[model samples]
Target: MVLEQLEQAVCPQLDYDYDLAIVGGGIVGLTLACALQDPGLRVAVIEAKQHSVAASKGQAYAVHQLAARIFQGIGVWAKMLPNIAQYRRVRLSDADYPGIVEFQTADLGTDVIGYVAEHHALLAPLQEFMQGCSNISYLCPVEVVKTQYQPDCMEISVSMNGELQTIRTKLLVAADGARSRIRNAAGIKTRGWQYWQSCIVAFVKPEKSHNDTAYERFWSSGPFAILPLPGNRCRIVWTAPHEEAKALLALDDVQFLQELQHRYGDQMGKLELEGDRFMFPVQLMQSDRYVLPRLALIGDAAHCCHPVGGQGLNLGVRDAAALAQVLQNAHKNNQDIGSIQILQQYEHWRKRENLAILGFTDLLDRVFSNDWLPLVVVRRLGLWMLRRIPVFRVYALQLMIGLRGRIPQLAQK
Candidate 1:
């Protein structure tokens, strides 16, 4: 049975409490729940924190074109649009370098290059959308104590309101984040290392209008990004050596703003701090496998990469959509959604694509985050080529905005 037939067919009764249970109610897990919101499959989302707490986070993300389309398909884009900031151009420059590369919307023949959305802006809408999805049971402020896998179903023990309860599901998904307890409990190994560098993120109010342009300025120390936000504010993702980043974060607001202005240049005029600064060590990680038996991993549980291009969450968004597509297809065909055979289809489809992005981000950070003469010369020449060649610009933009992969059906419309 295909999708049409499955929709027309009566909802089949199942022995398990739910068809799927997702651990981690972050953006990715919630996205998966929203995508799998059909009556045929009862779903559950297990979260350790309340929705209000997650929605109050200060982080923001660069929502690529493909991710925006995925949100549109999920029916939350209209609600998210009011809070999203669209950028028409992206400026890539090396520190004080004469050669620079700029990407315009015309390069891709799209309305805009991409969008910037705050954590609250995204999570609030997603949570609101899920409230209307009757098939999705959101169990928040609950802790997962243990998980036991059986031949036919997985049993999960949880602590909710100080009481232990068990829930059974046909499939289990781990979206718990990089230090995912579910993935660790299952003994899934990962490969990657912590970088000597760290990233400092903060919001700033620019004196001049950003003109809907995003800036990526690379220095020998690290890459500094200025992402335009709603209300003429800009998000700063400043990368630097670990010690240096810590010192910067410790400085008073006045001192920090002084340093910020030096790196930010005068294009945006004076920049005022909008909120507290945050720092986190950077790393690259990929699971040995995306799935096993009745267990599967998505988002940070599956992989993590450098945040240079703002690709982290977008990767997870795509993972959610792809997994949703694969699982729906399996359900329609009357196959076990958690069977390794069916799960591997999603793994095969996304793992390589994700690896490509991981490698690309690593290469970018390594190549640009230094003043090595040979590499500097090479990178400068690359920028020159990117500026002179429309095809190069288009290809690079496509990759950054997630237009270079096997798009899931949910994002197609």
Candidate 2:
């Protein structure tokens, strides 16, 4: 059903009670709502924009193997199969370092390193899936004006037509983007800062085939990644100083493409800009907490990390899965899913895991993006040793594929 029809179908009833209410229609929010919905429980999702508002452009993402498994568990993968493109390998290179370091799926005994897909194409099917399920109610294009936590339940005030309406739910989740209003109202604290670098993201049509592989190249400025999609199209994420980014983005399409070619080398052959380029300031954000009294945060709302290793969405997906499993287990055990005890467990499970990933990505961003001779020598030798040792290479590949650690319940076969 169209988003408009979906919104109109909802009954105008106040004092609606839900098992869970998620504030944010982004991927993580919607996924969490869908995951928590079942025959036994009712879930609702509230987003600031109407469903008719399409997902943003110039924001494509790569999903790790664990994320692929989570999608399968939620039953969205089958619907999204047509738009998905698997990348069997990835090539990481440094201009000053000798030789290239490659991570192949075969080396890890997997079929693909990961999958690359456009944000809209992936999210539309998820929304459609949520609509068909009877347990989910989607509230879009409505601003969350107030959020109040009481001893019994969490109360939310939403504005639709300059009139305020209240929603009460057993549990409240905040999946809104970076600046989460729900999180702010809950009085949760977050710690992060903006990076000196900015990222330029754009879709380009290349003259040569990408061969279903992604490339990450490090330069003095920052890391540039070219992720291959299904067609001759590629998504480019070029990181550099904010001033340099502004200068590059101001050039005409021809001049911009030329600069891209020079920095990107001949790997993808000639490139023609297919769409407008977008620039986003980079930051490393980690929340002080992910859960509070009957409240929780997910996705960029909870933590934002550097995109050096492309783990942002993957971490969010895992958060959704972890919360879902915890709730399911609580229900099975006749426990209160929204109880502080249950919420704290969820926080404990995800906080440590999220911090580990944040630290690893931060280290990579600092070590690889630097021009320091000592750090460069150490990293080059580290890469060389991994390549030379077959066992170490396979293990590294497995880690990159998100297969090295304990598999989450939803991700388990």
TM-score of each: 0.96, 0.93
lDDT of 2 by residue, 1-413 (tens): 46553343233233448878888888888777767656376888888876857466347998888988888888888887788778987888886466688888768676788889888767887889889889888887788899988756789899977789998887898888888987887778888788889999998888888899898888878889989887778888999999999999999988898899987778668888887899998888888989986788889999988887788888888888888888777667655556677788789988888888888777777888788999988888878877788888887666655676556777885
Instruction: Name the weakest run of 10 consecutive residues (lDDT summed) in model 2.
Output: 5-14
How well does candidate 1 score on lDDT at residue 310?
Answer: 96
Q: For residues 206-266, write the lDDT of model 1, one tens digit per residue.
A: 8999999999999988889999999999999999999999999999999999999999999
Best model per lDDT: 1
lDDT of each: 0.91, 0.81
Best candidate according to TM-score: 1
Candidate 1 residue 172 Cα shift, in angstroms, is 0.5
Question: How many pairs of residues in model 2 come into backbone collision?
Answer: 2
**Model 1: residue 383 alpha-carbon error in angstroms:** 0.2
Candidate 2: regions farther than 4 A off: 1-16, 54-56
